[model samples]
Target: MPKWTAADVPNQDGRTAVITGANTGIGFEAAKVLAARGATVVLGVRDTAKGSAAAAQIVAASPGADVRVQRLDLTSLDSIRAAADAIRADFASIDLLINNAGVMYTPKQTTADGFELQFGTNHLGHFALTGLLLDMLLPVPDSRVVTISSVGHRMQAAIHFDDLNWEKSYSRVGAYGQSKLANLMFTYELQRRLSGKGKTIAVAAHPGGSRTDLMRNSPLAFRLAYKVIGRLITQAPSEGALPTLRAATDPNVLGGQYYGPSGLGESRGAPVLVKSSAQSHDVAIQRRLWTASEELTGVKFPV
Candidate 1:
């Protein structure tokens, strides 16, 4: 099969897309492409100022791009609820919910709700947000929920059921891995539930070492090394966003499928169907994570 690129993204005229952390990087790139393709794109950002700026940039570039901003700080449940409520009131139905916001390897910290920062923002926040907005997408034909995972999921990832929050011990790398793994599991479990239902589907994708600001929080040594070698290895944010755009807009993509770079080590090339870690496919763990998420966030999926 030929390689999939953003050029393959179907026309999104009359579609409404909600993307989180779209102020910059691959998220911003994805939002820009969708807006250019005629989707009314809503930037769900922690900083409305940044979101507005991003929307303005898109408008400047696309001429008639319809883009808006919503305040969404994934670290707080209240913020998530408020953002969802605002989106619900303004939009009658959503055609896409792109769970693209995330945090990388940061020092041990917790969210406003006391959960680990990476897991809370990367996995749990998106989980809650998807549950809240899924109703709108449920009835729309070909609507999709696309979540962004990462290659890091394969690096020291395991669901620490004993300490899901990493209270007993803390390894930033392990925490990030756990959260990313949760992303894939969430997509798989959601696909299972949405199967044979309406047109809504759940898909996941990774940027594959894309050059983005997400790695700003990594260790200084890694950051310094990346500065020297990143240009040689990592793809641009536009290139990285292709996997996500393909997952969100590719008509042939099925629910529960994943996409990533097609080059060496799946790190830097055009987007293509990709495989996740074996652990991410564990159905039992997926259900358990779902239940735990619902209990933690007080959000339930209607599906």
Candidate 2:
């Protein structure tokens, strides 16, 4: 039996994929492999300069690879709308939408819309992006939406409805957990809604433990020092990207399914089907979160 490395990624000819935060780390790795396999990959990042460099790197590796960059600042609704409008105006149908960009532990911060930064960027940003672009995908056969979550979801996570913004108090770790948990719930609920349409499906994936720039802000009740534990337990960014790539391209993946590494506790190994936290599977909470998200972002799904 052969192991599933980036070499195993199926040919993605003629597919158009939009990947947020693709300038580096897992997102960049995913874009590189997909582009090499013949997909027209879009690197969605907050910095166009970095995005262009990432694009240049991809094209350099796979000479003539169709890859480009688009500015996407998840913390600002204005930026998200601008990005979506740009994408919608050009592409009538989308093959894949990967919500791979996220912010981890950081000092309490607010988005341009005044929401908690982690939740705003990690969940609402992707939620609104998916809704705005869903019409482009729904009419296209077999299009998929993949949201990246995290093992950090299990760390005292919940919606914190009364203070979704953490207005009264702030705990960066708690906010991060809530955001990641919302990622899974959003995927589950979105899958249910999309099931009736049949043209698209929603799936979730987590990097497990990966050495990526996204973790620079880590500080919490980590089992060990954040950087030390990550260095000891994490896999490379390319390996970290497998779950997301598999969730996006695997022909057998079903709506609402999750993908993660196969190593102990799903920290690092070959990508495979994995179970999410039990809370992620709860229907009632998922519905409530969906409504709250729609209200906050003001983007309604066509589904």
Candidate 3:
């Protein structure tokens, strides 16, 4: 198989994309490349200032780049709704919706909506966002919903329906894992709903051990390891964005499939078709999560 890189990203001319957390790290890298390839990219972010700066950088790198910014704080439902409405107003047909923004192992906290921080922002937030804007994607041929998961989905990952918010007990790593696992489950359920539609698909991806500020919330020992050995081993943000880009635009990609690194242990390498945890493929859990998410977020998909 050939090594896949940003260079392999097919032409995105005339495509419209909305990327969450597009101001930095993996999102920024994906936005930059997409914009360079002629897509009208919107940097959906919580900070408009940082988002504008990122848009400026992209335009500078690729003169004539059609790039802009929008406010999107996934921790707040209002912010996500406003962002989706604004983007929908601008583009009736969306080619790609990259649900990429997320939080890692943070000190226990809840979102503005009162759900646990990681599960809320990483899963429910994107769930609501996708539900709100799915109409814009359904009619567009080859449209895709690419939600970013993580290698962590295989590490300590489980959906605790009894205490989804982790209000009873909290473990930072465990919460993060649950959130990422929900991402995969959501994609599978979404694809099932999208089946036979032919025009739209739901896909997932994970950046294998990339060096990004997302790890700032990790414990002291893990942080120290990233500062030393992890730094030497992890892939770059551009490389980390590969799996996402492939999932978003790869012509051969199927709905319900996942993408990650091709290297050993899937830690770092070019993007390739990957498998998520078996728990992530549980249909009952996926259906349960989909229904619970709709109830929690008050957002329903057009499908």
lDDT winner:
1
TM match of model 3 to true structure: 0.98
- The lDDT values for all models are 0.94, 0.91, 0.93
Clashing pairs in 1: none
Residue-by-residue lDDT tens digits, candidate 3, 89-113: 8887899999999999999999999
Those runs of model 2 whose alpha carbons end farther than 4 Å from true positions after fitting are: 220-229
Return whichever of 1 and 2 wins on lDDT.
Answer: 1
- Evaluate residue 70 in candidate 1 and report its C-alpha lDDT on the 0 to 100 scale: 95
- Clash count for each candidate, listed in order shown: 0, 0, 0
Clashing pairs in 2: none
Candidate 2 vs. truth: CA RMSD?
A: 1.5
| Count: clashes, candidate 3 | 0
TM-score (C-alpha, index-matched) for candidate 2: 0.97
- Tens-digit lDDT track for model 2 on 111-145? 99998999999999999999988888887777899
| lDDT at residue 55 of model 1 (Cα atoms) | 91
